[model samples]
Target: MAYVTPAPLTEKSTRTDALTPLGLLTVLLGAALSSIDFFIVNVALPSMGRDLRASPATLEMVVAGYAVAYAVLLVLGGRLGDTYGRGKLFRWGVAAFGLTSLACGLAPGAWWLVGARVAQGAASALMLPQVLATIHATTRGERRAKAVALYGSVSGLGVVLGQVLGGVLVAADLAGTGWRMAFLVNVPVAVAALLCAVRAVPDSRAERPRRGDIGGTLLLGAALTALLLPLSEGRATGWPLWSVLLLAAAPLFAWAFAAVERRAENTGGSPLLPPSLLREPGVRRGLVLGLPIFIGFSGWMFVSAVTLQQGLGYGALKAGLTLVPMGLAQFAASILAPGVAARFGGRAMGVAALVHASGLVILALTALWVPWSSLGPLALAPGLAVCGLGQGVELALYYRIVLAAVPAARAGAGSGLAATVQQSCLAVGVATVGSLFLALAAGPGMREAFAIVLGVQVVGLLGLAALSLRLPRRLA
Candidate 1:
């Protein structure tokens, strides 16, 4: 027996409202905002510490809390879109994110701000996974490519732009709120996103939905908390006994979570994360490569911020300005990506990793030799700019690669899984590489520590590039 296939919906045949230019813009706006918030708050940390009288540990938590919650809930959030409606969840998340941003802005104490930040992360997790899912489901070849490129640029730009904007905002101390303005500023943007999302973003869902795997969700959340929380907080807490226990139990909990999810999937239940996604060749390669790219990326940013500010005693604005070379280089490089890929094949990414690693070595050398007071744009700018040059396209290409192997049916789950991995690696970067920088600062001190840590990042990135050379065979 043969089943009949449905007709393709052509642009001319479909309603004007479907895949309209306005719709794409709205979706793109939503994607940009989610990316921006992920890193905007970093520059605000110094002012937040003073305003809230936050301890060093709590201060770190303010950042880590958001990332951890965001990573852990993302798969579930994507699934929620599958079962309910992507449009509905996106709208709700946009609204909730606005309210939580307000809460973060208003909080009087460190703990209160931390809690609100966590809520904001949850709200973000709810909104972001739907972005690619909705776009993939709704668009076709050329349109999809353009939309994806925009998405990729926005995501990369957000991290850099966020810091620049936050630095200016914090320094400006608008209405005397100082760092609080970073959170407060999101309110208006959120409101705008909500209004546009309702009008322009169409409703979408998984064609076939199943009952959610509640057990898997619970166990996965537990495993993430067990592993991430302790690593993120342990150093500030003087490495307590319980922290070690949590670290030790992480693998066991993770295994159990994976087992539970597999069982759920086998029984016809829709697991929060489908195990089948883990088997995709391109997706798996993307995961492996994405780990080091982001780890080096996130860890370096964390260290750079502190080094520029505390180590060199520069104000937030100056530290932020120091990264202008990076941002500008990245913008230019992003536009060259397609051409580069066309000429070099997918190996453009491996070449990018090598270029970025060389830059890191130069940056590390500058910290070693250059006077803290005499540091000029020319001294290290070229290398750091090169790092940004590589980063701009390399990261997005992986996003493209991850989506390449996934089917329409698994788009939501795949996006969720990929985003979760990206988010988790960021946290791990902060814990492993970022913590190494901070620890090195305490004893070997900031200069030497910065050099050593960045050197390590250089090695990791080179290794990742080596791995990338093996990836053509892995492409779907």
Candidate 2:
């Protein structure tokens, strides 16, 4: 792929640069593709295990490999986009994603699939940051706000859609492809988006792009790997010596990463993630808020999928269908998020947290009281829908809060840093929350386990609600 240099735009000019509707759609498609892949594989895991004779440990890797790789490389990918050209990186990322998806679909064994998943995640890292960066750089004021909200909506919907689509595709067995179709489907979508992007997407780069922070990048990657790897694999692997050691070293690596970044900033070198960015009150508080939200969200999705399939003995299609109401509710709430934010200001997040907690409470009650034989998707629909609505609103508000203060020049870096936080929390959520549920299920039975997990999530939501009070009175 030839590197296309981005045309320079002044901060003044960038604020006025109108991102075409088609361009917005194209980038949003990229966002959807990346988000969907993360969750789609959850539903397909059973099929994958059956077909490939995958051990539980290997199955865990299929999910963790992509998540950890994506989380680790995201900041670097954002930096590359800012230094080079976002449009060029976006095209390359999409193409790579398509190819990697092909590799995943065609993999003949479990380990090959894990390798392919990691590569696919790397491709996703290259692509996803550009979506927010592009929106931030090319649009300003109300348009930018709306675009970000839409992106949030698309992201949340993608999570629900991925599992739903995965179930449908696995059950459909299109062309006898079975579980592979979930991945193979990305190929055509990527091609179409790639072709459309050339005409629709405008090229943009940071006004004063700096040299890559290789030292900071390496340390950040190492730190995230040390933290996430151990958490993800520990339960399945029986908490081995290596996992324990890695977990212990995670804090040390993180401290080193922080020290290196601070040093680089002091020396006037561009750190991969500028520590000063966190000094922006919006950026700092938003990230702190996002940690619990994403962790709870991803954990719930993973546990719900597993409980529905294994505990309830539901088919892939049924398990996937169960989440449709949630997806629809989230989609609706996202469309309304900007106006809600405008009206309620930061209080909207508190309201969203309360709403989310209510849904969890409802789900917990259902789990505790309902007979195992009688519980079904319908029984869970109201809670799921309510939960989705809260998630959509909270996510939209969270993105707005985090990026509101970021300068257009540093959009890629800012967006990348935010994305890294979101993705890493997502991985951790699955590792920690999913692990908790699985362990509890083994002893207390699925119903008790489900209720306990919901209770834990409700507590997290309460914390989020309290923290939202600290946000600035109004969004930028």
Candidate 3:
């Protein structure tokens, strides 16, 4: 099939050619795929290990490889959408994602599965940024606000649903495919998304497209890999020499990346991530605030899955079902967040943080007091639901706050940079918090370890509340 280039939207055309409802749904579907894949494999890890005879380290790679690759390539993906066309990239990305998901489903060995997962991550990197970029470019004012809120709702729901769906698929074991079904399901979904893209999804790109920043891309990728790779693998592998070296080198790469970006901007070349963009108060503060929020969020998810399945002896489906209350509450809160933000302004974030921390406190108490035999999904539901509500609010506001000041001309780049920060932090959260839980579990037992981790997370939320107070009273 020949590619049909979409007409570029002028300022006037943008207002006139609103993103159709189906178009928003199509892009949101694509966005959900990326977020869903990040966590879908969590519940399937035990199944995968049994079937493949995979080592613990390889299992970590299965999750980390996808996240690391996705985080590293996101900015380039955004730039490509800006220079080419978002609709074209969306289709290409969806196609690539489908193929990669197939590769993962059919892998014959542990290493092959890891490689396929990395490729799947790369495809996600390509697809996800376009969703935000397209929404940023195509809609404005109240429509833009609603689109973004829905995006946030989908994103949060996707993460929870990934685990839920993974559990259901693994338990169903369709045709005895077992864990592979978790990935194979994406094949049909991607095909549907591609078909919808052809009709419903509009193409949009930067008005003044900038050339890809090769030097900056390489430097940024290296910097992120250096930082995230060690944190992800070091604990499981017993913190080897290579991991320490990578950790030590991370800062150097980051400094070099900064210098290169600064030079590119000074030379009038478009940097992969412009330093000037970071100077924007919205962008800077949003990132600062997001670090703790996502770090705590992902960390909790990672450890919760492990504790439910391994410590409590819950089945995959049961463990996945454990999060259902959280997912439902989160979706509800996300839908209501825009109105809440409009009324309470940035204070809503602080309130949300407090709510999230309260949930963590509840979980910590339950973990400490409840006997293992009596504790189950029912015992955890209230805390999880509260956390969900807080997370929903935070996520919607975070996107609105971050992208509020970005120019339409740089929508792709700006959204991509924001996403990279989010994805990278998620990977780090899993590693750091997961490692802490594992270490404590080994010594103090699962119950004590869980309580400790929740305590740490609560402290992070307190910090987030403090930071949120600094956000401008009105979100854009």
lDDT string for model 2 (1-476, tens) is 01122235544234345579998999999999999999999888878999999999999899889988999999899899888888889899999999999999999999999999999999999999999988888877678878999999898899989989998999899999999999999999999999988888877888788988888999999999998888878878999999999989989989999999999999999999899988887788889999889999989998998889888999888988999999999989988998988898888999999999999998889877788888999999999989988999998988888888777777788889888988988878988899899889999898899999999999999999999988766776
The candidates, ranked best first by lDDT, are 2, 3, 1
Off by over 4 Å in 3: 1-17
lDDT of 1 at 139: 68
Q: What's the CA error at residue 124 for candidate 1, in Å?
A: 0.2
Tens digits of per-residue lDDT for model 1 on 229-347? 88778877888999899889888889998998888778777777778878777778778888888888889888888888888887778878888898777767776765565567567
lDDT, candidate 3, 19-106, per-residue tens? 8999899999999999999999988988999999999999999988998999999999999998888878998999999999999999
Candidate 1's error at 249, in angstroms?
A: 2.0
TM-score of 2: 0.96
For model 3 the TM-score comes to: 0.96
Q: Please give the clash total of every predicted structure, in order.
A: 0, 0, 0
